[model samples]
Target: MCTGKCSRFVGLALLPLAFIAIIVNLLLIFPNGETKWTNNITMQVWLMAGIGGAGLFMLCPSCNAIRAGGKGCCGEGCCGNRCRMLRSLISSIFGGLGSFYCVAVSGTALSNGPLCALTNQTGNAAQWGYHFKAMEDSYLFNKTSWDICVQPPNIVLWHIVLFSMLLGLGAIEFVLCAVQIINGLLGVMCGDCRKKENNNA
Candidate 1:
């Protein structure tokens, strides 16, 4: 359990971390921005973009409240910053959902197989294993694993590491977002904070 001051510090630290997440998410969505045939959009891309957008949106009030020295309370000793509180709730609900989707996608990716599939089609190993998972008529997932015929070595044990990373990130993001929402809600609870504060006083 973090104190108000401690929460401020953590929130401030998360600002940069959230920014990094945004950048990584954008990169994931647009792996080849310059390519003419780069419109290979996917559900994962949309989820990543939403997560990035939510993180970026959460930063504004977090930064403001932190910079304000935590004086943005709706009530005395109740909430810290009103905007931040709202951001936290939004982050918890929306950001948490986004993280869930990301994790779900990564799960889909690993479960279907061929996360890092490659093949020399014209060369010796032409019969690359095709992996497909039909979620629906509109959402068809596909990938390739490897060419067993041409592979003397090239193992993909590291796919485990990648899957773990995705799960870890999603879990962390959901936790942080929940924290923000709860902290914010606990801190504020009125239309007119000043009026409520004065009335309470």
Candidate 2:
């Protein structure tokens, strides 16, 4: 059986790792310079979605333990309960903030969708117009024109839906983590009370 003290220490140790993961994800989503890939709205949307999904996954464990079992490893010692509470609280805060960042980025990227269509038109119009007539002069050059199109609305809609889902899950996990931290604190106090009673007996 795991003691509360041991659980708290482990939880505390894991907090830094989780925080670092969040930082790395943010960097990957918002890279350094202008490049061909970075210019695409669809690519940015996917990147944000990926980062958000990862953050949510990282924060999920603390949430799951709290819901599945009332007391997470941290039992009733000075190191256990207090450390567990601190770790949980910090994780909850980060999770909520990360979710907000992801959703905001995703929304901003999607809003730029029209620019893609405009760029395609401006870049291709002149060349296509000339090619169309010339093609007719050749052997059956039907010169069908293709318009610059955004990825279908349905595909973008799915990315939006996924972003929203990840945000909601992060929120839920934060709340549950907070509740577990509070429960751990109370458990610590109760354990002290029982110890005093035993001493009196």
Best by lDDT: 1
lDDT of 2 by residue, 35-110 (tens): 3323433454455443453354445544533322323234423333344444544554454455445545544443
Backbone clashes in model 2, listed as residue pairs? 4-74, 4-75, 5-75
Superposed by TM-score, candidate 2 places the C-alpha of residue 43 at a distance from the truth, in angstroms, of: 6.0
What shift in Å separates residue 160 of candidate 2 from its native position after superposition?
3.4
lDDT of each: 0.47, 0.40
| Stretches > 4 Å off in candidate 2 | 1-43, 46-57, 60-80, 110-154, 170-201
Worst 10 residues of 1 by lDDT: 134-143
